[model samples]
Target: MAALISTTDTEAQSSGDPSSKRGGWITFPFLMATLLGLSITSFGWVMNLIVFLIEEYNIKNIAAAQISNIVNGCFSMLPVVTAILADSFFGNIPVISASAFISFLGIFLLTLITSFDYLRPKPCETGSILCQSPSKLQLGILYAALALVTTGTAGTRVTLASAGANQYEKPKDKGSFFNWYFLTVNTGAIISATAIVYTQDNASWKLGFGICAAANLISFFVFISGKRYYKHDKPMKSPFTSLVRVVVAATVKRKAVISSKEEDYHHNELIEEAMPSKSFRFLNRAALKVEGDLKLSGDDSFNNIWRLCSVQEVEDFKAVLRLIPLWLAIMLVSTPIVVQASMMILQGLVTDRGLGPHFKVPAGSLQVITIISACIVIIINNWLVYPMYQKLTNKPLTPLQKVGIGQVFTILSMAISAVVESKRLKTVGNEHPMSVLWLFPPLVIVGIGEAFQLPANTELFYGEFPESLRNTATSLTSVVIGISFYLSTALIDVIQRTTAWLPDDINHGRVDNVYWVLVIGGVLNLGYFLVCCWLYKYRNLKNDDQEQDP
Candidate 1:
């Protein structure tokens, strides 16, 4: 991955220069600050979106959750498109800058909507007979704001990570950056989930959204201020096109005889002595020398890319294909967590959330437990657990091992949630409702799972993917999360329509059954993940280990 750094860094280092104007630790503060601001702004609204819809729009509990899931999906999915654009056309800085401004615009619009009575439905008590839904014009304005916010958030999310990682030339430095990056993100989330949410609940929604808008504008400027100091990767032609070419070339030359000789296969100067791997022999045909395949003058380039591809290109496509099963398995694991998040909010609403005589926890702020737990787990793993494990085993845990451990935690969290919800149900109408403290254990467990899964998955993808797809690689986890959120929405809808397990009023529904179902799904996902881990081979394990070694 360090090899992906620009040649300027290498040249400066070789010249024994202590100061490189391009990129180094100097860019750290600016990038971290930018991330912190963005995280705070984005989470302010995202964490409380379901409640906002239910309270402000007169949306039913189930419908509000569904809308939240779709919003979450957009938050994750649009990044892949932005990442592709960054890697192929605009580069990261430009895309991030544009997106940040867009976010500001959206949040500002949200603030306006909150401040004005005309922009939302009339406020009505939950389950009221005369609840009024928003008119089409009002809905249109709200959707347009959400669209802008979602697009901006998705565009900046993964692209910023890739850009930050690009600034460092060492793997250890890159790893440290990611660690700090997530910490900063969680810290921002903590602020948003707690302080901002409290303000929204107790003070004013307009003020909370105003703060978010201000943060977005400030972060955009902070990012722009570092423009000259950052190391920028120039955009190249779309690498996705090359992957398609490999597939097309292989299909075109399907009947070509497999070659034993080295010269018969196409090789660029970088892999001149490399032989095609036997793992995916059929793909090797794409790089085989065949009739009418023309070579350009004095270079390894091919004139007809559709008919002939380099061996490296074929291998890159194979790497992507090999990742599918593991990706799907992880997506399944994440789906349950997504469902649990929305469920937690609904559960908190009907439970006792009092912390003391004068204070009550905002339902949306319950997610802070997860973020706080993840932060603590990350700190411990970085400073204690990972070091001890590496010393005892003579090698650190692989990303796959971390993911497996996370899957177990995920299952445990689901089971715990089911038990807690069951207990809550028993006391639903009693003089004393179930205390929100019971929600802590499951939330913390899921946070620990995330600490293991999210970073490990990001590291795995970034390390193994082809260099050309580095930005896209970073966004792969986002793609999984996006799809999982969508799946969670679909699953919730099915459950609502198919059974009495998830009625519009969760108080009347068996919410524990939903958690139990997630537990079963999580166990199945874990099984699938383990199988994929057993069968899959790392393309760059040795290099990755050396780079990751502390």
Candidate 2:
């Protein structure tokens, strides 16, 4: 009875509880969302910590970077599976619940293994006749732990986070929902990146895992707790049954077209408003077909163009298919963001910072730098960028524009990191210690880029994709990111081997060359982004299959 408050375990029942109205203090819905956001953010820190510990065992930096890919790759691939089920079979709530449970198990196991400190350097005696260690089993446990969290993360955070946000009332409360949603998420990031980073380094691994687990469990409870506040956001019926039938009936025009024009009046207005791009023309023509001669009221107009698209017409499919290229573009941009989890960590360790006891720079500390950067960026966006954008352009930045801007920052940040890396290299043998402060500047730049990019990207991806396909779109973005991480691993290997870039002594544990890898990556990404900007220009609002462009 307690858990049954929501229709399904995942969705909060939409019953008009007294708690539904937003007033004085934080509403239950927003509070729950905040907690969930924090949980997921902390989980990210947990994953980072786990990978770092595994890396610590090996003397080789490149191997550690490659090992980090295991989580990224699996999350990217596995989510597609969960998202498909979520969109088609299970629905978002159940997928979220199931993911949490999976994550719970993964973290518990990881905590148990870490409690034993299995990965810590094993005691070795001088010629003590081959000391045997039982750490391999623990290592396997560690990987499995990561997989569970990643799998849960894919569903709960990746697939359902925005979906969770969307279940609220829209058009009116939309901005508020996003406000709390984005703010809560960044809040979580700020905490996890700082507290989690600090605790993991200063405290034992168990403490770190336990903190994360506690946070995650709190998130699980909060989501379930507010079962009374959330509106039920069920998936549309399966394509095999209801959706397919709806498509067929519409295509055959047998179900009666009715006065759907009024229902779609907003769409027409949008078409009229679009720029004269090919996509706009395409949208206009297709819309014109749908609305053959706006003169004929309803049924007559429909019958006139009734046969235009059969149930499986090529053009209909193509209209739906057009969404793919844009989706791919958004997904590709997300790659660098997700890949940063491991890559940034490696960069922090190796970069030579001039200030030390001056600052006490630690190897795994660079991961925190991004967090600091993210906070700075997050602040500027909410306080400065979004407002300035409104004033400067008169028209607010579109989601696409926001993403484009972020890409530009991503290019610049990468370039700066590369330059810093090059600078650090020049000082390698010199008396100057690479001041950790130098890392801060590049990190802040990347953070600003992330601020500009991620939230807007998230909104655009989910909003632009048809409601039924949101989960799949989210998963696809993740997949693009996963591929990027794998590429990061490959780049690390190549850089480590081919070049005499890293100092040999610090080479294994230190990612001295990691910055170089980021430098090259930034150059390539910048070039790719330029091409995207050019191609993206031709797309018009009318041509888009969905998205009621402003």
Candidate 3:
């Protein structure tokens, strides 16, 4: 019955009528996503670079960095709300469109504030037109704009991709489309980060930011034009519906998980060895009872509830609950990768050797390498690595396994930076330009990690999620990335303030201690990645168990 339902849902979507614009609607949303990425992420990199130019600000450690954390954290937490809305009222099209517009507005406002300062002038002021310092008004605008953009990225970007994935015909095609989708996304981002960074570096900030805004608007236009082709799945509307859906879907996933576990139990795999702590287990056990009670007592007008649900429902509930911690762990590893554009990149600017005399590299541009490298690596991995691995091993890696591979590289990427830091420190005060080329190796490593993890993450999210909770799962994955962004910024703040040995010169952008700070983050990321690998290796959720029949 479950298999039937899953197949039916897939067919309902892919069985495109010849009279309808099957492919047109999908391209529209995807184009919107691309535009959103160009504009919003462009601003994101700009804001991050703004904080890193501490020399321009003159104040020591302006807690300005913390703003990234606050905004990112808030965005991460708010997705639950957006997810609910997407399920109920907004649907994918509305949510994506609305979020893009909101984010665009936020960025426009941010640009206005950044260009006009009341208190400080070098960074904000333009000759005669005085820019205000961090006034209450300007600060408010900054954060408010940040919140809007974050919402746009989290709410719209994540949801739209998941929604678009549904537009494809077959399950296998969906899997392939997502892979291509993610690849194109990074490719677009790579162009934005690098090209836009170059513009911001060589051209005026306004021009760079303006270009991004234009791109965003263009993206929205494309998405709107071909929306007719999409399969319009009615999103769950009521909060109660959303809540019930999450519960019901999670329960079914749990049953699949248990089935997978039973299979693993027979095979003597490392499934049992992969448990979190005793506390997590106890919580899971406790939650089982709560779910069982809820399933027994809650409104049950559906036929499935009337039949076999009494027994299988509880186990399915348990399985979905079981995966959250694991998700958290995997996200921990990816967070650093996500933050490379902001925290780590900034750290490189002040800490790594400058590109030339008084000519440090721009923080915003550093993100370019990661994106570019990711694109290059993705193409290679799909065409070369996966094929080579399959030929060599007779069995290719799965998504989680691929994610684990990415994590390993994420760790190594940081280690590469740490070594570079050691090099920069030795050459300090010499006035000789440190090769920005040194930054590329670490950046490339990060790219390798991203190519592996991001595609894997999207697949893991959709595959593991129950059909009803697909949007929620996508939202959850974005939140995980969001949380990591906040954590990375927070850590940067702590290190910048707490380090007793940071020379006054470097603190003010002379010594470039940013590299060292990132090195530490890399080490921390590595440790967490190891744990993610272990947990992912242990997780057991089988296709036959979770999948419903069409």
Candidate 4:
């Protein structure tokens, strides 16, 4: 039944009947509302997660931090798998709609847990030496809720971004979509960081989580409401399958004689013919037209499926192989940022968060600095930075260059964090708490760096990747983020055991030294990134040539 509906949609879309509605900006409102609602709900819970775990669940601070890191890691990483599923099986609309509903259920369950005493452990009394751990039933419920939420958010977040971009056909329009996409995302994040977080901190957790549940439920409904307007991409068999076939075919044909002639490679009359590039020439054998590789037209036999592939298939695999080094380099650039984000929350917890006599800022709300700075910086880069650079240098900054520049900013952010942390340590025993405002500079710097790199990274992947794998390409950003979150957790654990930098009570620990360590790591990663960037030859030289042509 599901396959029938998918086929109907795909056929309707492919036939190009004038009556067939595909895509337009009319879908923007629904997508934006859905994004906003999900962001508000998810970020509301996630940003304040450590506080919730520590206060409501009676978990220790360090334990709560670790749990939050793990949850975040899952949230970030699961998108890659989900994106693949969306592109391969369900398509974006169904996955996103399903994800929204699942997320709603998760948030609703959390709301119940907050409201019911039996769903949680007994609250620990202040100054108590002994604390009761949650029972298996309670832990099970909590983990189940988290798993659902993470799965839900992971599916929708990056997938929605890709879906939104698919609405437009032109590169400029797609580029514009990303600018607004990131902006909308940051706006949602800012609202969650400030308003939702404040409510969670100052009001009841029940109220905050209840709002999240309501918003998520509404988001799902809103997305469904726009079903008629959305342009749906048909799910295809996984492109990774074809990539594997290419590798297998290449390996099988390794001892065969090489052919330089264009006709030697298989080409369906439908697809334009081109010989495979010399780079990774061994893989070109996969496309070589061995005897009996091409069956007669209309033959239904599956024998040729593994032994032969199109030249484009071989080339696409080669593109991915070339991307590996650049991908690893970007991962290095991301790891420290994740570490800083996790630790910055810890810093905020210990520092004075009061703005004035009347109110106090929530520790999680402090991250609004990063979100806002990123939002602002993205605008500036798109409007001012790129144009000015093009005018001055007679060339626009490439994504790789933007990423390299962002690394410098990251290193700078780490340096500033180390310095500020050192000062905070010096004043640790003072009567007044160190002002939370001091944390803003480093956060802003990191945010600026992200503004440059994150969008550029997305653009690079989406632009360079084979048409079939664009969804997976977009999710590569999430992959790095997810890996970095886990790495951050591991780094913290190692620091805690091997050194005294990450004690539960951070005031006594040399947290400054940890930032310094990150600085050193960032510096090394930057060097590695430069090497990768220098070595990488852009696969899409047509765009580069066109830019240089004028």
- Highest-lDDT candidate: 1
| lDDT over C-alpha atoms for residue 523 of model 2 | 59
Tens-place lDDT per residue, model 2, 1-550, is 6345334433322444534332222334545553554454444444466345543453344465576675667766677777667767677667777787777777777677667655445544566534344367656776777777777776665545555555655555655665665556656665666566566766766787777777777767766665454444556654333234334434554333333232331232222232212332222222223444234665653333322322223222333445556555555555555545555555556555335344444445565566667667777787887899779866566766776777777767666666765666566666655666776776777777777776676666566554445556555656666776676666556766876554333423334345445546555665665454445432224444323321
**Cα deviation of 235 in candidate 2 (Å)?**
3.0
What are the Cα lDDT values of the candidates?
0.89, 0.56, 0.57, 0.85
TM-score of each predicted structure versus truth: 0.92, 0.71, 0.71, 0.92
Candidate 1 regions with alpha-carbon error over 4 angstroms: 1-20, 125-127, 170-173, 295-302, 543-550
Whole-model lDDT, model 3: 0.57
Per-residue alpha-carbon lDDT of model 4 for 160-233, expressed as tens digits?
Answer: 98888888778898778876777677777888898888888898888998989998998899999878667887
Winner of 1 and 4 under lDDT: 1
**Model 3 segments beyond 4 Å from truth?**
1-62, 72-81, 114-133, 171-180, 227-229, 237-310, 335-344, 347-361, 496-498, 501-550
Residues 522-544, model 3: lDDT tens digits = 56665665554454422234543
State how far residue 25 of model 2 sits from its true place (Å).
10
lDDT of 3 at 386: 95
The residue ranges of model 2 lying beyond 4 angstroms of the native Cα positions read 1-47, 54-56, 76-80, 117-135, 159-163, 238-344, 350-365, 382-394, 429-432, 474-476, 496-528, 537-550
Q: Would you list the rank order by lDDT, best first?
A: 1, 4, 3, 2
Q: Model 2, residue 24: displacement in angstroms? A: 14
> Which window of 10 residues has the lowest lDDT sum in candidate 2?
268-277
Cα displacement (Å) at residue 217, model 2: 2.6
CA lDDT of 2 in candidate 2? 39
User: lDDT value for candidate 1?
Assistant: 0.89
Q: Point out the higher-scoring one by TM-score: 2 or 4.
A: 4
RMSD of each: 4.9, 7.9, 8.9, 3.9
Q: Model 4: residues >4 Å from true position, as ranges?
A: 1-16, 167-177, 271-273, 292-303, 543-550
